[model samples]
Target: MKVAASMNRIDVNEVSKPEPDPVLVVERVSMKFNLGEQSVTAVDDVSFSVRPGEVFTVIGPSGCGKSTLFNIIGGLLGHYEGEVRIDGSKIAGSHESIGMVFQEESTFPWRNVIDNVAFPLELKGMGKSERLDRARHFIDMVGLSGFERHMPAQLSGGMRQRVAIARTLAYEPRILLMDEPFAALDEQTKLLLGEKVMEIQQRLKQTTLLITHNLSEAVQLSDRILIMTYRPGRVKRILDIKLDRPRTADVVGSEAFGRYVAEIWADLREEATRGMSDAESARR
Candidate 1:
């Protein structure tokens, strides 16, 4: 696991007070899936709130329904029970303020980098020139400045994911919902992109909710992490990360960082074991 060190870090001494308003409120949310005559609860009465400009992460075992909760928040799964509110108002369908970056590569193979990023703005009725101009800014932000015209096949996995992130940011959503966006990349690339994401979040102060299985990545990027139980997921615990700001890839070496990783691992190990046992019995 890569640890993060401080680089171009935000100055704590010059930090301004944050407003008290929460950007997202997920209240008593539950979700179930039906297959023929059988039904399974994926998430059970989960509740949490994400503060403005905060990077809040959810981590759990493979079948813990982390992705299910993310879909519910993004308004992609409307069959869910309970309320999901954004900016204090109930989310009826897909709200304009929410944006999602999935683990799967969502870049359009037919369009180049700039066009892919601008596609969202285009859908919003933005003019061609204006949308492309706006797309360039985000492309540059994700460090893909020279590759503006590169096709998705021409880029590496990491570069492709950057395009996806730039595309999401082009919409300028108030909250970013990232579901394991780095899970597909190699370790080195994953660490580099994770650092890039932290830098972007710090600079933009966009409220972000990330669902990840990587504990090290969770600790590096999150202000607080919500750990959930196995299938029929529930909030097991929410840990506040006290690490300093401007964390680079080197911070993973610190003793404090190790402790945080260890603590979360201890909690997750028990749940993972239970999930394994359940699967074994079901297979019999």
Candidate 2:
């Protein structure tokens, strides 16, 4: 699909350093949901914008409205309080040009990998042959070249996630939204997949917003990390990650990287502890 090409064209030299353009802007966004006698506020007064070709991350403790924020931005939930704009256009109830990948196993058990990857294309009434051809390229892009015929049951957790990512990338949206896509995997798999995902993002330079709880992950994969406070989430701080590109485990061990991680960790530790206490109180 030619749309894929438009989303992937980024100058390598301009990737690690992106010029200013608001690809996705969230302004005075807040979310409140009612559950019978009580109301729960998930996000409160949150505002930020993802610059073009930048990996912007939102991190917070569990139930701090990070996922809720993502849902609003993806146009999956319209019941929220404020505005989410994609390329300056409001996306309150639209999913026309944004790609999304979630933490769950999104693969279809009944469909083969090729068909699963091509499902989105098929939904748009694309021809089978053309969809298959496009799916094949994305399949290889995510490093699942030989497993095109495999079903969901035949692949590992990492492989399944790869398929999900490939499926999202095939359509090539203006912004890619990911919600802890590697959290369910083992540490090794998560790290490896994170690296692969970062590489692909670097090459494509697509505007991305990733929601994560892992401090190191937020540091390693993002150009800037937006730390959120406890429930009724708000931006605590936006820490810039200045580590060199093609980030690896080696970078994590560097002195400068350690300092950067420590800075973000200092902000997150207290918020995370508060979140735990809140969960315990809710359980009681």
Candidate 3:
């Protein structure tokens, strides 16, 4: 008799547990794009590492190449010169365990919330029952319990972003790469989703790298924040958030958190402003 094919189910608990080894270790990474005869450097020699179960954030000016850095780490920007190591191995191309959420809405208008969340699982070749179960679990984790059947068009901007996160999480990735995922939402929605994301990160203890230009968002969500300089972006500072766990967006208003934010802004604001000017000139 032929035996039934048993697929391996991803256990979130196993993913939550900290790896004895570092999850991501980026060293001296740089990227350059060719526009005609001119060479454009989007990212300079930037280096950082994320340990297992860390909420690591990269923040900078709008054109400071934060997203470029994320692509390098995700193996999406391979044309760059320098090294990006995930789990101690140098990444050469698209990596399987690195799940990404872009700034744009990633949901399919045709697919319902559950289906959108299950897309990654389907791509992984998981069976219908198993993928649906995992998708539902992540949808609930992102606070979209009753709206599992709702279409992307039916959900709010924040809800759509939540679905995107659920889709990434359902893959049970070793690392999550989020590029300004909440930048398009309303302020109130951004605040709420930011807090919810932080809570989920803490509960799951996933090693995540979030790239954003929002200072408050970086402070509220990350254990460590990496600041980048303009044009050819390079690491400016790495500020460790000393505050205790389970931090909310409101924590940004606290005196201690305020001090950290102010200090980091002070260090980068001038360079960030200059970066914008450089970008404008390049456009012309």
Candidate 4:
């Protein structure tokens, strides 16, 4: 995890309880990509750390390289500067300790809930009875216990996403990465799913890294939030949220939550405006 040049608010140490040693570390991470004839920087000098059993999120305007940075951390993309380490060892290209959920709908249309969740175990050549048994636990964990036989098409959008999450959890990766995994969902659904995530995290002590543009979503889910600059993304600011655990509707509706959202929105408004202006200027 990369640190911002400075934090915008919250003396993190004062607001939050002490945490265990970091589980993930991003050091001086940077990257750029070819855009037509020009090479555009996507991420620059980003550094941060995520502690064990914490939900750490990156929230920024679109085109802030959140996706690019996520890809690099998940080992999906290469040729990046710096390194990403899990448990103190550098990782590259899809380490077993890392499990990722993409922004797109990732469920296999042909497979039912059980099979989908069991797929990773199956890939590892676990016996059918054993893999399905493991899958059932995660299915229950994600609140899809009885939907084991239902096909992806039979489920609603939220259910499908739940299945996807269960599938990832079934594999039991040391760290979970979610890239705008609920961007397609409605607000109510997002909030519900978020509670589900928090519940699961509390039960499992899962260490998660999330990339989202939604301010409220970040506020609801994150223990800490990292902001990136408009483009050629750099760590702009990091803010800590001290909301009580097992966050509920009451927590979301509280004045504290509203303040967190407003603070992030204020920073995001400026960055997003810059990104839009940059896009317009480039069009000229």
Candidate 5:
């Protein structure tokens, strides 16, 4: 079994922060799937941790099991090797402390923004009026105060994603797991939404584990990034992004930011090539 290092080396920028105990921890996690008369390993001996109030990102090539590891951490996949923990307790299934925002627009088409954001609260037996009030605060946090009455179908893709985020925030989870939450949007929209996510993250000091393919987005939003190897993904490197916090879209232009991006891309290039080759072979 393999485990990621407790201390990550800095890349590009050479600053360090004191290490705190992890809010989320994965120990020697490995997941496998069985096909008809065949078996495949998706994630192999992966280990990492997310500190409180920091954005910890996972990045890798297409077939690198980033999503597989993410689902495992989210408790969406209950059967896997090794163990996962949040706030000290081991997870067997979906735990209330962990929340997920998927790549898909997850807002219910039938529910309006307030109703959608309040759904989780309602599930907890909070009164309708009180839940709506709580929902409104999260909706406002995502900058959707005026769209409280709008249904998912009535909003743009980005707006619907915002609604999904607000809905997750309504429950006030201790840890947030986002799997390519802004993946479907165009570049400009992704950047803008990323800014909104950063704003909400800073405000709430939410401990987040984000899975993304966009290096620029990772550089802009992450405090540290864990790069994975191709197929049967394992930790290849962990790069501490020593950029100033409370970041925005404008930060992408800085020399430090560009260096981080370049450094990560260099690390990913060969692994991505191997992934592409595997993809072609599988298609044959």
Candidate 6:
């Protein structure tokens, strides 16, 4: 696969001696769930690190515990076997340094755009005027400058997601965790929002970890993608993306982009088939 020369490619050696100071570290994390008298292993021995300002993505088949792993990292679900640390500190619960935007529309229907974006700041006890000022800046940054007064009901799906992003960034979290935030949107809208997200990441330089099933999205938005195996998720591979930055929708048409997408798809196809087979057998 075509790899970016300048990108910090994660090889066996690089994994042995990672960056001197990674912004986020997820080491040997494994999770299991108990249902009545039975138990289920959701994630199995997954480990990876995201560097400062890097957009790291995790992709895998359905039921591979992508969302579960994300929750563990966000400190929403605890009691996992391994450790998750941010800035060298273990994450015990919801951390101030981590912000999350989920797949569902999280915008408050009663609040206007500016109010929604400023909610995080409100929780932090910032004065209304100061919080609104910061909120407006992020709103403008996310291309929702004129929608500051619009309510969640007034905006489209993609627009509402933008509002969520602005709100999340207002708090200035060191790391951003997105759980398929654009999965519900149309392909065109998803691509547009992906570009917008990349622009925002470039501007803020915040370490971001996105869990997406879209191969194209992974290839387009990630500096490195961690592909997982079938159910009871594990790191299958971590592939480096070579495409140059400032990426837009047009990048999808490039030959290099296609190669990266194909490579990832090739890796995932087998795992997806296996996952489907397991599901079918369980149904029987």
Top candidate by TM-score: 6
- lDDT by candidate, in order shown: 0.88, 0.83, 0.83, 0.87, 0.86, 0.89
Compute the lDDT for candidate 3. Answer: 0.83
- In terms of lDDT, the best-performing candidate is 6
Candidate 1 per-residue lDDT, tens place, 1-284, comes to 33223212223221122226778888888999997899999999888888999999999998899999988999889888888888778896788899999999999999999999999999999999999899999999999999998999999999999999999999999999999999999998998899999999999998999999899999889998888999889888777788899999888888888878888898899999989999999899
> What are the per-residue Cα lDDT tens digits for candidate 5 across 114-193?
99999999999999889989999999999998999988888999999999999898989988889999998999999999
- lDDT, model 6, position 238: 85
Candidate 2 C-alpha lDDT tens digits along 136-168? 988998899989999999999999999999988
Ten residues in a row with the worst lDDT in model 2? 3-12
lDDT of 4 by residue, 146-193 (tens): 899999999999999999999898888989999999999998998999
Candidate 6 lDDT by residue in tens digits, 56-152:
9999999999999989988899889988888887888899999999989999999999999999999999998999999999999999998999989
Q: What is the lDDT of residue 137 in candidate 5?
A: 95
Q: State the weakest 10-residue window (summed lDDT) of model 1.
A: 7-16
**Model 1, which residues run further than 4 Å from truth?**
1-19
lDDT of 4: 0.87
Clashing pairs in 4: 1-25, 1-26, 1-47, 1-48, 1-49, 2-47, 2-48, 3-47, 3-48
Measured with C-alpha atoms, the lDDT of residue 277 in candidate 6 is: 95
What's the TM for model 6?
0.94
Q: For model 3, how does the per-residue alpha-carbon lDDT over 1-284 read when each residue is reduced to its tens digit?
A: 01101212223233223346778877777888899999988998777778889988898987788888877777777778777777777888879879999999888999999999999899989999999999999999999999999999998889999999999999888898999999999888988899998888888888899999988888788888887888778777677777677787778778867776776688688888797777778799
The weakest ten consecutive residues by lDDT in model 4 span 10-19
Q: Which stretches of candidate 4 lie over 4 Å from their true place?
A: 1-20, 282-284
